[model samples]
Target: MLVSSIGASIVQTVGGAVKIHDMSWVTGSGKTMSALLLVPDGASADDKRPAIVLAHGWWNNKQMQDSNYVELARRGYVVLSIDMYGHASSDPLQEGHEMDAATGMYDGVKEIASLPYVDTTRIGISGHSNGARAANFAIPIDDKAATPLISSVYLVDNDPIYTDETGKYVNYYGDRDVGVQADQYDEFFFRSYDANGVALTAPRDYIGTPNAQSFLHFGADPSGQAARKPYTTYTQSVDGRDAVREIDNPAQTHPWGPFSKQEVTSLLTYFDKTLGAPTAIAPGSQIWQLKEGFNALGLVGFGMFLIAFATSLLGTRAFAGLRAGPAPALVPREGRGLLWFWGSLVVSAIVSGVSYWIISANTAVGTVSFLGDPPINPQGAVWIIALWAALNGLVAIVIMTVSYRVVGRRTGVSLRDIGVLPGWRRFWQGILLGAIVVASAFLIVFVLAYFFTTDFRLWVIAIPTFTPNKLAIAGIYLPFFLLYFLANSVAINSFNRFAIRGREWGNTAVLALANGIAPIILVIAQYSHFFITGELISGFGGINSIWLFPIVVILPVAAVVTRKIYRATGNPYIGGFIMACVVTIVSVSNTLTYTR
Candidate 1:
C-alpha cells in the first residue's frame, strides 16, 4: 500500500480507542516544532498513564515512529513522536538543529506530563539515528539547568562516543554502524559537563542518575544471520553465571524493525519490564544477553587464520618471482638502504603507539592509566594491553610489507638485500621525521580545536596549554599523518611513473578518473554511515555540514595539479611538498574563517 494511504488508514482502523493528534510547540529558542501524539482510547484526564516521546532518524519523519506508537498504545501507554528541527512538520532552524529539537522534545514531554491523565513520574524518551543522538544529549543535561526536564532514555542503533587505544570508538559495533559509537553518548555527556561545569554534568554521571534509567538497544539481525555471525552466539559471565544470548531475529537492521507483531511483543515486554508495568518483561536485559555471545578467542583465531592464509598466498613463488624480473635495475637508483626501511618501520610503530595514547588522553573521557595506578580489573587490563600490543605488531608487519613493496620495486632490490642503517643516521632521521609528524599533527589539532572549543582565542595564536594528554594526542596524530603522507606520495609517484609510459591521453584520463573518483568515495563513506545509523562524525554534521565538502572537492583538484607538476618537474618530492602546502593553506584558511 502507498505510505500516505497507510498512514491515514492506521488511526482509523484503530478507531476511537486511540486519538492521534498533530501539534506544534515553540522551543525556548523561539523555534516552532511539530509532533504527533497518540492518546489511548478513553484516556481520561485522571487516567495518569505513562508516556513515551519518540525522535525520528535522519531523513525520516514522525510517521516512522507510528509503528512504535501503535504498539505502545496497544500496551496501554501514550506515545508521542516528533519531527526534529528541519524535518517533517518542524521548521528549518540551523545546522545541528537536532540538538535544539531534542530540547523541544523535552519541552513537549513536559507538556504531556502536565496533562492530568499522563503520569508525570513515569516518563521515558526514545530515539533512532540523529534522534538517538539528540536523546542521548538531552538525558544528561542537569535537571535544573536549561529545560529542567528528565526522563528515562532509550537509544536505538546509535553509537555513543568513547574511544579505545586505536582511536576507534569502544563498542561491540564500533565501526559497524559508521556514525554512532557506544562511547559517544558518554563523551558528549562528559564534555557538556566540562563546558557547563558541575551544575550540568554532576547529576547525570551514572546509569540511574536523576532517578531515571537509560538503556541502549542495537538491532542485531540484518541480512538474516549474515550480519549476526561471530557476534551472533556466545557466552558471558554475568552476575557470576555463565549465560548465553543468541540473536534469532533475521529481519532487524540498524534500527529496530517496525512494530510488527513480533517487534510489538518484544518492545512491550521491554517497556513493561523497565517502565513499571505489572508483568515484568526481560527485554531490557537483551544487551547483557547479547554480550554473552561474543567469543573473543574465536574472533582472534579466525583473524589469525585469515592472516596465515593471506601470507601464504602472497609468499607463493609465482607472485614473488614475477615482480623480481624488472626489479634489479631499479634498486641502486631508487632504493633506501635496508637499514633505513627497518628503522623507519620501528619508528613508525613507536609513533603510532604514542599517537594513540595522546588522542585517547586529550578526549573528554581522559587517558587510560596503565602503570601509575592498579587497574580496576587487572586480568581484563592485561588482556586489553596484550591485544593492543599484538595489534601494533600487526600494524608494524603491514607497514614493513608496504615499505618493501615501494622501496623494493623502486630501488630494484629484493627484500632480502635490504640492510640496516648506521646508528647515527637512523637516530637523526627518526627524530626529524618524528618532529615533522608531531608538528603537522599539532597544526591539525590546533585548527580543529579552534573550531570546536569555545576557548579558541586562548590557543589559536598563543602557545597551547599542553597537558600530558594533549601532548600524547599530538604524538599520535603526528606520526600517523607523516606515514600517511609518505605512503600517499610514494604511491602516486610510482603510479605516475607507470602512467607516464602510456599515451598522454591515457595518462591524463587515468589521473582524472582517480582524482575525480577519490572524493566521491570518501563522501560516500562519510555519509553512508548516517543511512546505516543516524549519527554523523563529531564536529561534522554529515552531508548537511557541507563546510567540509569544498575541502573534499579541492583535494582532488589539488591531486591533479600536483600530478601535473610532478610530470613537469620529474621530482615527486617537489610535487608532494607543493600539494601539501596547498592543502595546509586551504585547511588553515578554512579553520580561521569558520572558527572565528
Candidate 2:
C-alpha cells in the first residue's frame, strides 16, 4: 500500500518471468515493515535460490540499490532491497525521525529471509556507507529470533571484515591510503569504523599494477591526483596468487552499487568466489588486511600532555588581567597588610588541597581500573596538582581584591564613628557563603540525578559501581556553573554603573535578555542531538528539552521585575540579591523536578 507514482518503476522491474513483489513483515516489536522482492524467471513453488539483501546507506532511498538488485538478480539470485525507517517510503519513528542503521539492517535481513524464493540457508547481505555498517551488525543475529536474517555478508568497497560471537564476517570498505584527491573518501570510511573500535587499513596486496591503480578514475590522469600510491603498503606476507586473484578494478571510488560493466563483473566474481564458491583462507591473513596503523600508548600520552600544556598557558593568560595593582593614596585603608592576603592564600590552599585529594581518590577508584594501570605518571601528576593550586590562588586573589575595594570605600572612617566593629565575622561570612553555594549546587544536582533517571543507576550503580569518574564529572560541572554565575553577577553590577536613562530598568533588562538568550540557543543545540544521534545532552535525562525555553523567558522577566522593585526602594543591592535568590530557586527546582 505504498501509494506513489514511483511505484510504477517497481512494477516495471516486476514484469516478465521474474516476478517482483512488495510485502510487509513485522519486527520483534511487532512494527509492520515493507520491502521489494525479486524472484527469477520460471520460479517453481519449491524453488530455492541464494538471495542477497541490499541495504541503503545514510540519507538514501531503497532505489539506490536498484543497480545492485539488477546485477544480483541477473546472476540468478533472488534480491531484496529495503527502504530503512525514516527514509523514502518508510514510517517515521520519533520526533527527530532518525533511524538506527544497525536496527534497520537486522530487521531488513530478517524480512528478506522469510521470502518464499529465498534460500534461508544461503542468505547474503550488502550495504553502502552507513548501510555497510548495518550489514555488518545484521549478520550475526540468531535468525530464529528476528527479521532481516543474514547468513553471509558482501561489503563492496567496504574495508576488512570481523567475526561476531557467531563467527560471521563484518566487511568494511575505505580508501587503502587517503590523499588530497581522496580526502572525503577517507572521512566516509573513518566515520563507519572508528567509533566502533575498528580502524581502516590499506589494501596491501592490492597496491600497484593496472588492476589496482592509484587514480580514483581510469579516465583521470594519475599525475593530477595526489602523488602517493593508491593502496597501503604492508610488510606482512601474503600469497602471490591470493594477491593477484583478489584484486578488483581500481576505477571505483567507494561506490556501493554496481556502477559499470567492469564493476558488476568484479562483484559477481568476488561473491561467486567468496560466498558462492567458498574458499578457505587463514583467519590471521584477513585480520592483517584490516589494520593500517598501530596503537601506541606513548604517542597517546604525548598528545594528551601537549593539549594540557596548551590549556594551562591559556588559563594563565586569561586571569593575568585580574592581578592586583597599587591602590590610590587618597583612601585611608587597612594598609594592605601581608598577613590578611597571606591568610586568605593559606585558607584557599587548604580548600584546594582537600578538593584535589577527593578528586584523586575518586580517579584512583574509577578511571584507573579501566585504564589498565593508574595514570600516576610523576610529571602529569605534578602538572595537575600545580594547575589546581594556581586556580585556587587566583580565587584568593579575587577575594583580596574585593576586600581592598571595601577598605577604599571606608577610607578615613573610624570603626567607632562608622558604628561598626572590626572582627572575623565578615571575613568568615564571605568564606562560608562561598563554600555553601559551591557545595549546595553540587549536592543538589547529584541528588536530582540519582532520584530522577535510570542513567545514574546504570552508569554508576550497575556497571563500574562506585566509580569516582562520575563524581569528578559532576563536581567539575557544578562548580563551573557556580563560578559562571558569580562572574556574571560581577559583570552585570559593573555594567549597571553606566546606565542613566531609566538606569535600573535598562541594566536589568539587558542582563536578563543576555542570560535568557544564551541558554535558549544552547537548548536548541541540545535538542538537535536527537535528530543526529540518540544521545541527549549529558546529565539530567534530557531535561533541557522541557525546561530551557521556559527558564530563558522567565529569567529576563524576573530581572525586569526586580529592577522595578529596586527603583521604587532606591536599593540596587536589594534588587541584585533578589535576582540571585530567584535564579537559585529556579535552578534547584528544575534539577529536582527533572531528576524525579
Candidate 3:
C-alpha cells in the first residue's frame, strides 16, 4: 500500500501540471526513436509555446531527463526528452548511423518543430555527454538549410564548440544562442594537453585557456585579449546573425553534471533568454528536486516491495516446503573461529574485486562467436558484468571447498547446513517462486511507468521495465549471474553467517557489507584517485569500471534479501534465483543493445 502511494505521488508530481506521453516516431532516415513528450496544461496550436528537445548521454534513456522535462513543461515550455538510438525503448542503432554526424538530435529537433503547439522558429536542442555531441552535430546541419530548425543549443559536460580536431577554434553553430555547462572535473572533456600528451593544468583553470577564450570571443584569436570570464553572457554578430554565448563551469564531475541545481538553473536561465519562457519565474526557484526526492523514495519502496512480496509468496501452500530452519552450526563469534569468518570475507572481497578488473580489461562487451548470434544479442555492459560474476563464482566454489575441508568438516557444517541439500522438486519450486516474484515486481513497474511515466531510480541507478527483446537477452545471461548469486547465498548464509543470539539485525548488516564491500572499495579507490590526482588510476580498466557503481548499490540489497529468504526457507536457492533473475533483467534492460 505504501509503495502504491509513492507511485501515485510520483504521478502527481510529474503529470499534475503537464501531460507526459510515451511516444515514438520514425525519422526521415527511417529509424525509430522513443521520447517522453511533456505538454503543459491548456497548450494548443492557438497558444503556441517554445519547445526544447532534451537528450541523455550514452546508455541512458528519456526518463533520465525527467528533472528537465517537468520543470520546463511546468513553466510552459514544450519539452521532448528522447532515448537515443540503441538505448532504452528506442530501436537499436543501425549500420552507418555511427558515421552520421547527428545520431538522433536532428530528428528530435525536427519532431518538436512539427508539433502544432510549438513555436518552430524558437525550437532549441540540448544534451549531456554523448547527447551533447549529438546536439553539437545537429547545429551545423540545421544551420546549412535555407530555414534552420533550431534557435538555441545547450551542451552539458561536452567540448565541441571550443575547437576542432587540431585544437583550433571553430564557430559551426551558425549564430544560434549557445550555452555550455562545462564541469571542472569532467572525466571526458575540456582539457589542454602538452605536445607529449600530458595535461598542462587542472580542469578548474579552463576559463583562461585558449579554447574558452575563443569560444567566448566568437572564435577570434585571444592572444592579446582581456581574460575571459565564465558565467557571463556575451553577444556577437556572426555571419549577419545576432547570437549570444555563455559558459557556466560547475564544480562537479561529469556524471553529476545534470543533477546539480546549478546546472539546471543555468539551463533555465539560458532558455529564458533565448527562447523566452511563457511564465516568468526565477531560474533559481526550482521544484525538480522534489521530483528527484520522490524518485529516490520510489527506489526505497521498490526494495521493500520485493522482499515483502517474496515473503508473502513463501507463506502460501504452493511454496511452504521451500522454507527451512537455520543451519545446525553457526560460525563462532569469538577467537580463531571469528578469525576464519573475517578472513574468508576479506578473501572473498579481494577475489571479487580483482576478478572485476581482470574480466573488464580482457572481455569485450560486444557480440562474440561463443555467445551465439552476434546480431540478436545480449551485448555491451551486460556481457562485461556476466563474465565477471561467472569468474568470481568459480573462485567462490574453490574457496568454499577448501574451507569445508579445513574447518567446516570438524565443526559439524554439512552440505545441508550450507543449503545444498534441496531435493529436485524443491529446486524447481524455488525457480518458480523467483520467477513469480520478479514478474510481479516488473508488472507493477510497468503499470507505474505507463500511467505516471516514472520508474524507481536515483541518479544512474534505475529499475525500469524492459522490452521483450531485453527479456530474451536476460535469459541468455541468467546462468552466469545465477552462479555468482547462488555461491554468494551459500557464502553469506553459511560461511560468514555470524548469527548472534540477540543481534539479528547486526548480523544481517554485517553480511550485507560483506556482499558489497569489494565493489564499494573499487568505486571509492577509482574516484578518490581521479579527484585528488586529476587522473584515473593507471589501467584501472578505464572508465567502464565506473559501471560498478550500480553493482555496489545492488549487491548489498541482494545480501539483505538473501538473508531474509534464508531465514524463512533454511536454504538459499530461492533468494539466489530471485537476485539473479532481477539483476540480470536490470543489467540487460538499462544498457546499450546492439543491432549488429
Best by TM-score: 3
Note the clash tally of each candidate: 30, 12, 3
- What tens digits encode model 1's per-residue C-alpha lDDT throughout 391-434? 44355446556665766566663333322221444334333332
Worst 10 residues of 3 by lDDT: 365-374
Q: Which residue segments of model 2 deviate by more than 4 Å? A: 1-15, 93-101, 143-149, 161-187, 190-249, 255-261, 274-596
- Name the top lDDT candidate: 3
Q: Write the per-residue lDDT of candidate 2 for residues 336-421, one digit (tens) a residue.
A: 43344334435544554454334444544223211222122211222232233345435644754564465424544333222122
Q: Which whole-number lDDT from 0 to 100 does residue 26 have in model 3?
A: 83
**RMSD, candidate 1, Å:** 20.3
Q: How much does each candidate deviate from the true structure in C-alpha RMSD?
A: 20.3, 20.4, 2.8
Give the alpha carbon lDDT tens digit for every residue of 279-335 in model 3: 878888877777677777877877777778878887799987776755454433776
Question: Where is model 1 more than 4 Å wrong at Cα?
Answer: 1-13, 101-103, 145-149, 161-252, 255-266, 277-596
Model 1 TM-score?
0.35
Per-residue lDDT of 180 in model 3: 93
Instruction: Compute each candidate's TM-score over C-alphas.
Output: 0.35, 0.33, 0.93
